[model samples]
Target: MQTKINKVELRNLEFDDYKELKNSMVESYPEMVGSYWREHHIEKLLSIFPEGQLVILVDGKVVGSALSLIVNENLVDKNHNYSDITGKYTFSTHNPKGDVLYGIDIFIHPNYRGLRLGRRLYDARKELCEQLNLKAIVFAGRIPNYGQHAATLTPKVYIEKVKRKELHDSVLSFQLSNDFHVIRVMKNYLEGDTDSKEFAVLLEWNNIYYDESPKLINLEKSVIRLGLVQWQMRQLNNLEALFEQCEFFVDVVSGYGSDFALFPELFAAPLMADYNHLSEADAIRELAKHSEPIRKRFQELAISYNINIITGSMPYLEKGTLYNVGFLCKRDGTSEMYSKIHVTPNEVQHWGMTGGSKIRTFDTDCGKIGIMICYDVEFPELSRLMADEGMNILFVPFLTDTQNAYTRVKHCAQARAIENECYVAIAGCVGNLPKVNNMDIQYAQSAVFTPSDFAFPSNGIKAEATTNTEMTLIVDVDLDLLKELHEHGSVRILKDRRKDLYEIKKINT
Candidate 1:
């Protein structure tokens, strides 16, 4: 009487499926004739806890069902019996304030047996447990075939045999394969049952992903505050002086309770003063030699101030090649480096630096973030790819020497914020370095930008600094609000992106 199902759909149990559920239960568990759930019982369970009820439909016909209820663990301790936990098969012990999920029953039609339908139902229950943040799922599984050995062996001995793989019970074997471990055997779990001589196996599946800590819900409290310093370029007498200047900014920003502080690209150019006797290209090469010490100092500052620092851009030399790389020093004394992906003509022709090929995003405790140096943000495809990878914030560090160069970076940064629906923070180097070559006559303005919508500020600017000024602008960004706007905004740009018509695919080299 087996029926081959062509199409299968899984959905939450509705009132209209009560009759089908009753029929399916009866057909699936014929041994429990009087134990079959009535239609009214199904309706009552759905009305009270609909999220825990689910059904599997095969070509518009109900073929399987899984039902669960929430319960407090304190009420059902380690030694509690099944009848007391579920209230005599009526689920009167269901608790809305419970942290654990209690599995009441699951059945698939006899004709649809061996189709892996039961596995799908179990997976759905696991997913529901995660969404509700439940602690674990507990159930009493019947060992139907244990009745045959009841005359010679006790329930404990039978379960041991099954665990050792010397014996197989239909229900216990299936549950074990699905990651449910047996706690112990329960006597008189189901009255008048032929299975296990009226005994059942207590099983549980723990939710490993459950977080006991409270979630970040308050917008203000959940905000990640950033202090952006538009560093002023100047003549430096020595490396010690340059380090002292950097520490001054960090000390000031740390007092304001900022979680992260950002600096401009090539802000360390003044450190190249020690090598001014060499050519412009040789000077950058000399700066690259101090990359290790520079990174070590940034890491120490990050740990000392208890703040994450973005060390703008440094001339990094590796394997006989020079690169314009930015370093992110985390508060935990760790760091990550991102090489500039789009090198400007000045970088390639004058500094002998090449562009990086790979685009990457960093995973932090606050949120997922991406770093694109100056010219990189101008390319729309790069930011879009990063947004696709769940980046909520994009940091741009620039070192523009002219108003026109600064405008190009600023406009493209704003456009990226709109197209990707993400926060964009731009910081640049300012002031004039008269004695330093290729670093003099800087023009810059730093800003924190947001998406253009009703939920955001009217001007889309969270905070901005005065043009060509040496200042640090602090701003707080709400990650939860960003998520809400992405889903229910005035215009859903991330959702409306036409992937079918066109997509920005990264070609692996």
Candidate 2:
């Protein structure tokens, strides 16, 4: 048997490909044989708007298709059905001067399903919708599997379940996953569509970059207000006290509607004052014991306060070795850990801390972010790796005991913001722990940084806390500005990288 190479590409559906298109359509909806689209229908659509007729070709053979046509949203009512929108099979509803792209048909062959070809087709439609300056991509999406649950569930309830991920519809599920939302449940959408039971969903995917009026930039989700907590070293009698103080700051940050609430690296070290009598290494391990419970409580605080909390950095014990790690507790009740990629000499000597092995970008409700603990921010490679992953902000939680040490983290982090063209926020422990060894003294001036350009602050420091003071510095950083700077800035290091001479790739472990 000869080895067959599978090559997949997308192109406009041509009139000559009508036979294979009908064949693939029937493979999914066999009950509607003659009722499906015919050669004349394909020729008519191609003649009217050829770019909207997209087909996926695998090994030079058409396997799937996404069909769409422009429609004036003002002329059509929201209650319109499939036949009415398709102009009684004549497609008279297609308007060249329209505000929306009305999706009419989509189908895939059984052998080519699950390859995400539908997403590619949807993307092509979205690109065309944006390029044509359309307001949105509107479609009547079929709930074909609604018949299975119609005996007990209503169409509205079924759609709700699908949106909540409690239920799945072959078509609607895929659409919802691709950012399309249900405007409402549509009825009598198609004739003799048994699987759908004559029900459909009015779905829409808005184009963010659509130009209604001349503007500098257009983005719905951009600005992320952050609150950096410059935590103090205090005498806490128990673990609850530490949590209470942390919760208070979270409350304040959340009250101001900040997207992120960050604490200092080892800010919870005050809890380790209880184990001060143990050896330095043993005490760090004891601090590791509190990591699990604190992560849990911070997660609760994140949900209750409705703020994302970076729990700074703490000692993490795995197997027999110890590592420094931070927990990013998102308001959605999920916790992610970012271990320090590079451990300091003092940490290795005193706490038996080893560097972590994995690093990846974090997806938050606000935007893509990354966490690099104290010493990790000093290395340029880590932040560059994060920038490659489209990181909008980088959080550095440090615990430098000397003013020089603090300056090292501060200067390098600022450099990262300039070079990566992303925001950088740093918070660290202030004051001192009288009892805890190797953690006796600390210094930090929590600050938020921005790319050094005309759009940003002159010094690139958005806001900064008073030196070694326990306070939260609240600042709103415009992610839209970063997008603008990435393209047209004084220096474009990311785009100007000499990829022909060098490249950076992550090695899989």
Candidate 3:
């Protein structure tokens, strides 16, 4: 005897399933009218990233489908319309090595709406993101029910109410429950979508495991602005005094809408006043104790100010050994730690500071970046390794007791910009810290340097601070210029490297 059993399965979309997929899309979006994918459309998507295209079957019948593509993400503007994102139905925007998994379409059969099929499709996308190590799952989702309230409420207010749960939207509410947030409301996003009033919301679901993944967003930004702080060495009464000063600069930089804010090395060293009577090494060890507290505070400030911060170099103690460390406190409430790879002879002799073992370039919303300390910037090999990692900007925070020491860092950093074909921003301390041993006076001339090319300033200096003054220098840089220089400039140093003869590599990860 033969028996019938129920079975449901989810799998990658295939070319033969296009007809069934089209029927399901129509049933899910009856009012969509003329907006539906054809056979070639499904063919192109599967050809590009088959893992991103999925379909669900109920007892051998296709009941739902989801189509996606990988995009550079830097080209995904919030105000972009549907045609702009989809490449006018040709899917020409698909990039094989892109960082974002873009969900171009998702729909379920009308009869299968209550089976949680939509959620299943979404979970699959998240899994794909984790497997591929992409930054996020981004898409423009329609507000289908908004057409009903279009006469009374604006799209922005409607979205706000949906978030607050005062109003319910079928598509948006489901997405929010699936951990997606609306970046902004867009106009004329789709054609012939009367139910949505031609509006959509730019939604994003960040992959939490992105940091562990290889940095894939090398060309993430086009226009990026940076803020550099020329800090003044001073004596502080307590830790709170240092906190107040740190918050002030963060506030000023964020107000200028700068994406990143840099503070000089040892900006928190003002707390050394309490340990003035101790030996220099012991005083630094005592300063290391405050590193944790200040780290937590900088993380808070980074979140509150909506700016990425390089919390200048601080003394860190591990296994009773002292190391100079700095953190990249991101506005997303995450942080990355890096240390000075090359410790200075003066530092080793006076403070017993040990060199750090690991180094890495960072991934940011604007672009890829690298961090180096005072003495580390004097070495060309370190920055070259970072350039190989696709670093677009290098931030150096230094502490110099004399003009000669400051000059060494500045010249080497500028040369790094020219040779690596990237931007380098260097900052250091100024003024005097009287009564503190080995910390009496400081010298600095904080500046932002760019690649030497026709696209940048003739002198390669984008912006500079007044010598030895406590102030902020804000400058804008176009990363696209770096791309052009790499491909078409008069002298393409990065692409023209003599790799066949000489190469640089890190011995261990």
Per-model TM-score, in order, reads: 0.62, 0.61, 0.59
In candidate 2, which residue pairs get closer than 3 Å at backbone N, Cα or C atoms, i.e. clash?
A: none
Largest TM-score belongs to which candidate? 1
Worst 10 residues of 2 by lDDT: 213-222
State each candidate's clash count: 0, 0, 0
Ranked by lDDT from best down, the candidates are 3, 2, 1
In TM-score terms, candidate 2 sits at 0.61
Residue lDDT tens for model 3, 211-255: 543545653457888989999878788899999989999999999
Which lDDT tens digits does candidate 1 get at residues 127-224?
89878888888888889999899999999999988888899998898998787888888888777777667788988887755667756772124488
Model 3, residue 187: distance off in Å is: 50
For model 3, the stretches where C-alpha displacement exceeds 4 angstroms are 1-220
Per-residue error (Å), model 1, residue 402: 0.9
Please give, for residues 1-509, the per-residue lDDT of candidate 2 as tens digits.
11453698899999888888887787867767676688888889999999899998888878889898899987445588888898988889899988899999888887788788888998899889978999899998888889999999999999999988899899999999777877888888887888889988999888765667654643335788999999999999988898889889999988999989998888888877889899999998988999999999999999998889999988889998899988999888999999998998988888888999998999887879989998888899889988999998999999999999999999999999999999999999899899888889998999999999999999999999999888889999998788768755888879889999997778886
Better of 1 and 3 by lDDT: 3
Cα distance off (Å), candidate 3, residue 72:
18
Deviation (Å) of 326 in candidate 3:
0.4
